[model samples]
Target: MLVSRCKFTGISAPFSVGAFVKHLAVPLSTRLHCALVNAEGGPQSRAVHCPKFQALKSHQKEQLHLYVDALLEWNQRMNLTAVREVGEVMERHVEDSLSIVPPIRDSYLSRCGASCGKISVVDVGSGAGLPGLVLAIAEPDWQVTLVESMRKRCVFLEHAVNLAGVSNVEVVNGRVEDIGNDSCFREHFDVAVARAVAEMRVLAEYCLPLVRVGGLFVAAKGHNPEDEVKNAETAIRSMGASLLQVCPVESHGPYGQRTAIICLKGHPTPRKYPRSPGTPAKEPL
Candidate 1:
């Protein structure tokens, strides 16, 4: 048996390995209640029978369930995501985002070197909060900002965050270009992460400008990204970022190719970055 704490107040419930012992925590919010989860695995485990459920904390497991429920409920009226089936949502959207947790944590460790606290993160073009909302549920200690240009998506994101009982998340309804220059957000985050937002070059511009010097931009993309990386050379360099590594998404179950492109920011992004709203996609650096 092992113990995992609730994100809201750090209240824990114990459960035996390989079986979920249903329990609830001190609930400040409805979603803060606990549920099924297995508490067995190393930091990088490909060992569990269920892939998505492999490494979740107790609260995170329940959080995922609630998040999926809300997504399914809202998706009917709003078309929030193309992934419609429950199983597909688990594998493609939810677990795929969770797969990046290792590298994101490694990046934090690289920056803080054994220190523990919230690392500021931004999810650029977070349509329906694929990785942003999922990351927040899995890593509750990390402060996550969901940046979506579309108003409806922002409203959905805000609801999802509230529904998940996540206090460490904020939703920003604006484009990267506008927000990147605002003093409140410019080059202020420890990490900028995006998935299925845009091509690598365009993503770098939208993401890098929001990352502080020494921060990282982790872009989740489909496999075979050589051309994307090659095309992004100029944009990456101009944004004061360098390719760190491309890690395979191995923990998210057997699926099509998926990779996390990690970029380390070496210096401040040039002031002209993320040029007016659609310029990054139109002009591309």
Candidate 2:
């Protein structure tokens, strides 16, 4: 299980097979092959699974492999994910995103309020489409919009989504706030996702307006998020929203614990929301 955790963490350092099991909680079996250290800087080491994560889930393993291959090949010409290697992509990008699936799905269901099965999703500030692409690949039934304002990143996202052969994913070149106000997009999605974008207050403005009254805005962030959340209270309340939960994510790879702040809209957002392009960044609320 410890090795499983390391697989999720994407540990990069190398070590002798015996020393690995001694220090870490992973199973020590003659079948296990090699040990690698954490790439993100830590003495914490990880033993490579003998058969790798592929063996565990043979059915969909090939699809995951294909996605990583696409990401790496694309990164060479156009930037996609920060972690360039295959192992890092699987653990850090894949598992890390999947860890939040439960909340995202639940939040989607709550928004649908009886439509519990599948729903549409909008990934705001989808740089290289982190959780958005991952979620689209994992749940093909749901439609996902990859909203990005940067032209180059949008090009990369479009290429990546097309190359992945993921019919459910669409890349939109525009700011979240601008998209949220569009007549076609206003209150159009069941769930909205943002990862490492702006602070909570600013994110609320960017995301809340896009979701229907009962929909959710899920903000993915690093370990400590209290100050960001506290700072967003006014924006959250004023927007007819409330904090649902601050879900702590147990890191599966080199990174440590993460957090996903779930905010729910209690009523329709005021028409003034999103306040011109850089307004949220200039003044949070």
Candidate 3:
């Protein structure tokens, strides 16, 4: 039997794993409350409000649930996320991923005239498919590519995609640095995004090369990332991108606030960029 304890309310309850899985389909309020269970059997985390998850359609919700189920099951075999409980996954990962949808969509629409055509997006360092898989699930018309270097994570991504039955996602098993230089991937996407991948400077090199001149590169960052944004200014300029805006997003937890740093690709990236595999992190611009 598994026991769940609420950190804020100090409430405890015991239930089987099977029962917990079944409770995933319960109403948002109940599920959100139940998600506070801590993985260490201690008090659960505080409840999070996910307006984005609340906005999902029934079928979309079903797909997300399936993906979360696979994530929790696979996590037991390998390290995926620190938050193991289902509700926490929904709050921290699913809803956190969903938070970027509006910014990406609105940014594209505001710049591209709202034609609503198919947009190509690439997710760099997509460990466990945070925004990549979640984005594909939310926007069916968009083509999303999940780039993960680890073969094991790639396998898990494929399995989760298959289980969710989402056909718009493609899992690639390779380093982002190499992919950035590949003709097939370089400058081929409408937008590129990364979350918890690296610092802003190093992350800019990995993602900007994959975006076309008129495209966007969004980095999911923690709250109070002004210093990081300032430090990465040189790197951002070197990558042919200009700092567009730093948009505030929903808080992930006690982390205060989260933000999305949006950069506009104005010119083609220099061939020298992404500098050899493992080079970017070793010596950033």
Candidate 4:
């Protein structure tokens, strides 16, 4: 396995905002000044004015800022994400991640009724934590597990989680297929989500097994997924899930319109599903 050959970088000390700022590539004074300006909702602060960002509590906003700083810092050392600039990161990554929150909440509400409570969410193929860590930071009450096959990405996820001081998240350095079959994880979560991970058919195989019956499986995809959703109908049913909705998300930036393919897990997934590692992507369903 990749993890067997990979080395882990442990963060020995507890992470703090001050400690994190000092470690950034930019000068501390400049970084702090920029942070202050954003906090004050200056003309340079686009994220602060974003409706999704503005909806978060004061501390949640700060945690998100810390997460962005950590992501940018780590990206310099490793290929965490292609979006490099701060504004782009907020719009493309952070805002894009936050877009799925409503669908998840609505799904939870429609199924369980009343409040969302403490939901368990797993992000399959969570490269650099995208919606996984961002979800954890936004809704601290929910438990989020990030499943990433790549060891280096898992390392970056751990670092980001620590830096953001978010305790609701756990990083798993393993493949979804393997994790899906594990008794401890199979059908264990209330919700499973993936972003730009795979086609709908393949993603259904990878994510549906980890979701319990009556839970939700959300796939974040590009706008206009009608064809992909139509193509994946057979696979979706085979995996014991049914397409619930293809909700459109308001574009946060030039990344363009987005969609959340929400599926409802009405029954348990077949045991042989997800196939072996890389099989789902190669053979699909």
Question: Could you tell me which 10 consecutive residues in candidate 1 have the lowest summed lDDT?
Answer: 1-10
Task: Order the numbered candidates by TM-score, best leading.
Answer: 4, 3, 1, 2
RMSD of each: 11.1, 13.4, 11.5, 5.9
**Candidate 2: tens digits of C-alpha lDDT, residues 45-145:** 22122123323344334444455555665566555656755556667766677767777776666554656457788898877677798788777778888
Please write out the lDDT profile of model 4 over residues 1-285, one tens digit for every residue.
Answer: 112222224322233444444554433123632662455443337656667877888888788877777777677776777877676677778888998999899878986554776999999988988789989988888999998877567766776787668899888777676788777789999999999778887888889999999899999888888988998899889889898888998766666889999999989889874563444342110
Expressed as tens digits, the lDDT of each residue in 220-252 for candidate 1 is 877788899999989999999899888777645
**All models: lDDT?**
0.70, 0.66, 0.75, 0.77
Candidate 4 clashes between residue pairs 3 or more apart in a chain or in different chains: none
TM-score of each: 0.78, 0.74, 0.79, 0.83
> Candidate 3: where is the Cα deviation over 4 Å?
1-49, 113-117, 251-254, 276-285
Ranking by lDDT: 4, 3, 1, 2
The whole-model C-alpha lDDT of candidate 4 against the native structure comes to 0.77
Clash pairs, candidate 1, are: none
Over 4 Å off, model 1:
1-49, 111-116, 251-254, 276-285
Q: Which ten residues in a row have the lowest lDDT in candidate 4?
A: 1-10
**lDDT for residue 268 in candidate 3, whole number 0-100:** 96
